[model samples]
Target: MSDAYLVRYVGGPLDGRVDTLPGLPDEPRETVTHVHLHGGPKIVHHYDLHYALEYGCEYRLREAEERDLAQD
Candidate 1:
């Protein structure tokens, strides 16, 4: 099964944007991905693993504890 990740924007114009995304490919790849905005659903053009890495964003596996804590 594919893993889920919490993607957080740490810097740049998109800073503070956080969303749950499906785990990327095992190997680094350059491809587009989608992100949901707080106001509404919008497409992020040309989003990819490399782009995320270059922009100071972070991706962490979605752990049970974190998910539970967030709901508390």
Candidate 2:
């Protein structure tokens, strides 16, 4: 399995400007795994980038090629 990295830009919708939270700052989403910046399923931050790796999501990355195509 391998790892991946992602940079996320924070800055949710404006408050009251929409129809959700009246005059409050936009709410932050959850933080991602291994990514402490931006927002994922944990902690909190703003206008930051996050790095995430998903091995299961990329089975092709771990698959064999050419002669091993049948195994794939």
Candidate 3:
């Protein structure tokens, strides 16, 4: 197995972004990323490993919780 592999992000702010992650798909995985909207505060997004395909792994974006939303 390779030391690192490619993963595809689905949905959310990181949608369509490809990243090189270290480790094998032997078990489930989760990842977090940061995004800064134009003229807005930085936001964090969470994703969970969903599928392992021939080309790469797919991570589905998790729904935003109350805390994930920006407080007015």
Q: Can you rank all candidates by lDDT, best first?
A: 3, 1, 2
For model 1, residues 6-69, the per-residue Cα lDDT tens digits are 5564333455777666765355443323455677667343333334553233533333464456
Task: Please provide, for model 3 over 1-72, each residue's C-alpha lDDT reduced to its tens digit, 9 standing for 90 to 100.
Answer: 656778888888778999886765576465655565677777766677777876668888866663266332
The C-alpha lDDT values of all candidates are: 0.47, 0.27, 0.70
Question: How do all models score by TM-score?
Answer: 0.30, 0.16, 0.55
Q: List the residue pairs that clash in candidate 2.
A: 4-52, 4-53, 30-39, 30-40, 30-41, 31-39, 31-40, 31-41, 31-42, 32-40
Report RMSD (Å) for each prediction in the order shown.
14.3, 18.7, 4.6
Off by over 4 Å in 3: 1-5, 20-28, 37-39, 65-72
Q: The CA-based lDDT of model 1 is what?
A: 0.47
- lDDT of model 3, residue 31: 60
Give the per-residue lDDT digits (tens) of candidate 2, residues 1-72: 323322233243211221222232233333322224454565422222132233111111111243254335
Q: 1 or 2, which is superior by lDDT?
A: 1
Which residue window of length 10 is worst by lDDT in model 2? 55-64
**Candidate 3: residue 10 lDDT (0-100):** 89
Evaluate residue 25 in candidate 1 and report its C-alpha lDDT on the 0 to 100 scale.
38
